[model samples]
Target chain A: MIRYSRRAVLKASAAFAGASTFAIPSIVHGESDRIRVGHLTPLTGFLGALGTYATLGMKLAVEEINQAGGIMGRQLDVMSEDSVNPATAATKAQRMLEQDGATVLLGEINSASALTVMQVAARNKKLFMQTGARSDALRGKNCNKYTFHTDIPNTVMVNAVGQSLLRDNMVKDKKFYTLTADYIFGHDLLAAAKRFFGANQGNLIGDELIATDVTDFSPYLLKIRQAKPDVVCSNLAGNQVTTLIKQYSEFGLPYPIVGFNLNTADAWAAGDGNLSGTWPTVWYHTLDVPASKAFVAGFLKKYGKPPENHAWIEYVAFKMMAQAMTDTKSTDTDKLIAYFEKETEFDILKARKAHFRAWDHQLMQEAYPFTVRPKGQANDQWDFIALGTAVPKAGEPLEQLAPTQEQNPCSL
Target chain B: MQFGFLLEQVVNGLVLGGYYLLISLGLSLIFSVGGIVNLAHGAFYALGAYGCVEITKYLGFGPAVVLSPIAVALLGILFERFILRRFYTADPILSLLVTFGLAMVAEQAIRIVWGAAPLSASIPPAFRGSVFLGDFLFSRYRLLILAVVAAVLLGVWLLLHKTSFGCVVRAGIQKPDMVAALGIRLQPYMTSIVMLGVGMAALGGAFFAPITIVHPAMGAEIITVAFVVVVIGGLGSFWGVVIAALLVGVVRGITIHFAPAAGEASIYVLMFLVLLVRPRGLLGERIEKFE
Candidate 1:
């Protein structure tokens, strides 16, 4: 065997490591002409199903934007990947900004993950158009200058459903037992729900904080039955909501189930006959607006299915980001933030155009409370829920349901 | 009144334990016979649920549940022949890595075929709702799962204890060299054991699909709990797995009743305590190969 000198070995290894560093940036930043945007969402775990839809929606928007000459004539190169969890999300966001050369960040359905991503964006001084995560805290206490939230927050969802409950006269003097997901998102929602109850005459007799991975809700169901509450409210998120709903139906508890949070994907996954009661949604494919109808038709044509709310939000967010880049003539984070801070309205396929609230950077838009259609009335599997009228009605300010500056601690 | 509610949780836990038994028994069996910790066991479980969902469209829920497990077991034949057969006498780490890779591949394969969204499944109308035995309420579907688990456990017990086939399998587990010296090939026995093991996991998946969210990662979610049961029951102890499974379920239910946040953590805690007391598990026996 031939042996080399120790100095030679060290020299060769150092050169190789140095070569790798040079090679990596060249490959990663190969397309200097294209504008890179980083997209992340939970493509695994409980929120994974919704994340899949979010990716699809982002893809569709990217395709459309490119076809329409892209953002400021530079084709967008969106690097979409699974956020996995909050810690992973933050790490990925940091890499996307620093290494991947992404000018802007987008996409997330999990609130906790979104918060971490927001922190990363703030640290990097990058723009993050948070697409689907709806925790009020993300907009309230955790809000940052670099992150703009698109989805309605937890308080909006609570008020949207709370309005329906009030109309049905179910809130006053009602004894409520709640099952909350044991996470930041769920805790925020539970706080919103408690606030709603406290404002109304509803009594929160019992509430259980459920671990995210707990598949069996039978024990929780038993506890609910024992409480004998007038209403059972769900503040659980992702597929946990579906599991809880299915098991709740399985137990056939007398108390009607309602929730402060329920994504369209989660609601659909509950199946037709099993789902009942009112729930809040950011958007539904069945919205009657012309642009909304066109988006749904196109999504159905391409995907062979209607777009979920997460999908709609991601699509709209990408479109708005593209518009921002076009109007501002740059992908610079500070410029984009300034443009959004001007509160320029963008058509989000809703009855009214939405704009970022200048103070908190929360998207001021319409939220809808939905209820399941009567059995056998649905045209197909996706058409099970009947969308209610948009909250705040036609003449009212879009921010009517959102938390005020007094309630929210956000300063940026 | 509090005691009555606690009793309800305990009873419910036992029923839940029965479901856990369906998954862990097969895991325990494969480990006993082949000494290969099948990390991809949960993949078969996920396949069972997906198979059941696919078949339910044409054949209804009753036929789907039965056919899904049978179909997955047929796949297990190939699994044993190609993958597991080679790794039996090799380094255990190799088998573990191969199976872990296979589990990821299976999850991705499922994601491709079924889409990333969870497939919707519902309990049959007859099996919906709860039944009250005195004051304690039982989900009608869970009771059906209990019956199926009991039947499966009994059938597996009779097959393992009474049959001549089991004798060779048992003999193979205890002394592989002796069995080879006696001119008996353990290959066929190993194949059957794997088939039965994965089939049981699939059966658990099929039954649980209605109650749980039927997603691609559901297999990964369940494998952890299944492994915990297998560990707590100890290696090579069928009765040990059964007792441990029920004990885990009861413990989880009780924990949820008292401390809802720690319901999922309670099982690992139980596993920790049991391992601390008896490292080999509650009923684990000493087999020559593992030692």
Candidate 2:
């Protein structure tokens, strides 16, 4: 599946990038002495804890690669900085690449922050193997050849779960109420839910978006309790997810809740069976197979805690970068990208086999549909067993949802 | 959407009002007597939450109880003489600014020392369930919180109105020259009053810490609502502030039920409307102008 003509793609100004032909620097073209990978994440603010966990995962991945004879004897020299804001991420991207000599940069959990870093990647000619952002626009129209997504995009995750429900007969004419965290992520996830539901047989009765900084959900829950839908879809993470599900259960809304992002293993860790029986669309989980189990076990053995879906993405990014480096047998940025596109079936952190789409640069991997179990049968972060479902090839010639890079100029 | 929704919103508003009342009472008391707003009041609340979390986390205490407020008050005394005494005679606004900076410094300090993330506080293991109302359910913890707040308010009122020290402080606020002429050193009393007010804020913070995260900006965010209560209640009028706190909370709560978008906005509207009604506020005493 790894096809390469090596013809240079058209280049645009900094105001726009239309899949430019990458010019490899003469220095690291054939040599494999050492490759520096840069990373940026928010280690402060409300989302700091999640950011730290993601950062630690990247560091651990770097360590594993270094231990195993390095990337062709050139270890990943880690250079990380805190992208606390758009301005900060932009600055860090410069320092990591320009000053620190990072060949490829990875790690940004926040999608808004990732778009900011994308500008830096375009300017510096470095590959940003985006690890944890889920915005759908990162691929397709907004996508650049220099940009390779490691995180599962929302459209991909939604489509996987949507199709699964259709095949499994889970998508019946069920009424849904959404308690979305009010933001771009929340809005897009809810919209996808509505689209998928419309595509399938599911019906959306009501939806509400909660502000990001809202400390309490009791007031909002009051309205939800009154409406009482069959299903409640939520888009929230970290402690907010923990607090909401706990309060939702307390309100005793007879509704069965299913959230795309909320029903992760991290939710269970923060909350004790608060989200049991909820189904979520996830990139990878341990329950699917042996690689996932080993990854989770290795993570727990080292970190002394279970690897949530976020951690799996970090592990995968590490493996992907290592694979691209191995196949090209060179550390040049352009050659590495060519090697990535040519990468047919690579070893991901979780599943034994994963394929990346040549058209969209989207990784075709398995998504999980987990049914949360009650208190008695809980296993660490997981509620119930997870079922494996395959995501379709990413670059479908269907209707494009997000404005592509050519349409939306990020620099301005 | 329904009549029940409005009814439920009112209930929700009351809960918010009650919480604000607890937080603002301390702020108002300190401002009238201490001549400072005590911005660090939110920190006390956060610390109270952290205390409860720590006690429960390490010691496995049932839940962080109202006893946290008492600890916060004592902590306030240490902060008072060292910090408040230095700025007693300065401009009132200067003191306010100082305290505001202190609040920021205190919050960051707390975050640096304790780590910036939300901490967990349980509904006292005993009262963790919910009580059914007509259509909605209310947690026993919230009811217990309201009850504790009431008791603290009563205790603060009793101490302020009943004690001779309270009389002297009240007299000093009314006529500082007379109190000073009578040979009472205002420094000790002013310092103690500042301590008392800060302690109350800390207590409020500690109680709320469980409900919210112990983040650095938390103090600044809630302070707006607390300030609104202070402004609408009339500066230096204790009861007026109390009533104002309740009114704002209820307004915010009900707004959530109905509009949800204008939860904080409705509070400002209520304040403007109240200012338009009675120039000094409902319970504010008229002052004789002095040059």
Candidate 3:
């Protein structure tokens, strides 16, 4: 007798249901007067903490916009879904488009999920403002007309951090040992960092690709000891940061450390004041900019803690999309895309003005390099990172932070 | 690699193998003695780790380490009594499904209580430094882990080989009807053994917590690897589990030194090779109940 697996049965049924539903026009379930924004982020997996903050950030933005008379005199309506994985993300994106009547789609933390969401957005001809997936490929080889990324790509992050490190005399003549997460994001980040290091005449002594679910870093730590590199660059993500930093400090390997991108949530998880080294982020709650100060105060008064980098990006992405729609007075995908590409000059909660680069629809915003606050200098538990270098010193001029035209030639 | 560095890698392998030994031992016991497939043993492990982290905040580290495993063991006792006991005489697949659901519940419960972000416990001040052993630097905490695991393994061996409880358990594994005919209450013995197995898993969690991050999904990560080890060590053999855990751990350690990318995949490769050679495992015993 042949037995079918539960997953296969469910997939078959979902395909049948989806095909049938696609034939019918979407019925708007939300308030007819409100403009619906479908917010899809990983709200329940390993990235759940960041995703929760992302949801809160978007909620705060929507409320502020609605209170201030939302775009084109319509209140913003949000339909949130947990983008669990790529397959589920694609399914949910289709559901949002065909059943929920979401006029705009945004918010995805995983790059793979964001790619799938981008595909759905392009297929439906809806405006998608991607919040936080750092793969440069989204703006490069996979560039689509309907999707716009508001987060810094991996190439930008690596270049920004690398330039800052070099200017600080940190990696000019030093040997570096790197432990990278073994996946698409990690591979992209490592490649970008290698390019930056190669340009700066730095030596890469050893590099190891670590598994995503690795709980032990001792083997890699031992190898680090033997290599005796002057600096250690960890290109790992999520809880890998916590495990590696804690174990690194415990092992007492005396090397200055840095990260390509480190989330503030991970810094908090590395409690007992174990968070060390310099890191770069698109935004942080402790930034000294006026807009950042306002966001931090508002988020703190409402949510009881400052917003993380992910939260900051989500908040900025929604506000940018909303402001663009208001300026153009149209929610048409072509109008929004043309408005952003040709005439959109927006405040990105930074000191300088940022705009969507025409070549690639990436939000060319300033990146912040932060150092872990010393134990005595920290004012509170979350005040763990402070600015390492002034803005625009390393991450500026849209052309410098991102890849050159020769490297990322796009036809859009 | 230099001799000293290679030796350090071996030591690392031993520490990792000791951990796999404790976790796989619990999986092996639940399958062998109770004839129940427990997929949630790793959840108990996570509970033990998170319990230790929370307890350390109120009590000191020593008391936290001691009480965490006991708390998890009590939870195991309750779980075995209420949920697992119902499926004891039922189809084994029922137990697998029940435990798998329990695992999901435990993971979500942990998320609600502890939050989804990964949390870590710092090493005790006493175990902070490294031991300089003539050209090699070994972490003192890892050495302590190795010693603690060795003692636990030795104690377990003595319990299984040199006691009347061991005889009853061994006899029950092969001939539960004979043990029942001899006027012994097998149900209580089975419950007690289940508690012991789960407690060992918790103990491993408590010890390994300082070295690793304590997250809700950490248990799920280890459970799959533990199941692989159990399968490769034979379904219900005690010695088979011990040997397989160490072998897998050392091989993984060496593989990381050579090819870091293949380190995780190498465990499955080893499992495949072992199954090809000995379908029942390295020290698999012929158990008529499972057949």
Which of the numbered candidates is closest to the native, going by highest TM-score? Answer: 1
True contacts kept of each: 0.80, 0.21, 0.55
Q: Any residue pairs clashing in model 1, and if so which? A: none
Off by over 4 Å in 2: A1-36, A66-75, A94-102, A159-171, A263-270, A281-304, A326-331, A376-412, B57-63, B89-121, B124-129, B135-137, B172-178, B186-221, B264-291
Order of models, best TM-score first: 1, 3, 2
lDDT of 3 by residue, A1-412 (tens): 2356899989999999999876645446436777888899987655666787788899899989999999999988888989998889989998887777788899998778899999999999998899888877888888898999888899888877777787788877789999998766788889888888888888899999987778878888988888889999999876788888888877878788889977778777777656677788888776778988999899989988788888888888889989888988988788989998894788878877789988788887788777777777878777768776544554436556778778885666
| TM-scores (chain A) of the candidates | 0.95, 0.80, 0.90
**Least accurate 10 contiguous residues by lDDT in model 3 chain A:** A22-31
lDDT score at residue A112, model 2, on the 0-100 scale: 70
For candidate 1, write residues A87-186 as lDDT tens digits.
9999999988898889999999899899999999999899999988988999998999999999999999999999999999999999999999999999
Question: Which residue pairs in candidate 2 have backbone atoms (N, alpha carbon, C) closer than 3 angstroms, thus clashing?
Answer: A2-A342, A141-A404, A141-A405, A142-A404, A277-A372, B44-B202, B45-B205, B45-B206, B48-B206, B49-B206
Candidate 2 residue-wise lDDT at B102? 80
User: For candidate 1, what is the DockQ-based docking class?
Assistant: medium
Q: What local lDDT does model 1 show for residue B46?
A: 97
Q: Where is model 3 more than 4 Å wrong at Cα?
A: A1-32, A44-46, A67-69, A394-399, B1-3
By DockQ, rank the candidates, best first.
1, 3, 2
Best by lDDT: 1
Give candidate 1's error at residue A79 in angstroms.
Answer: 0.9
**Cα lDDT listed for each candidate:** 0.93, 0.67, 0.83
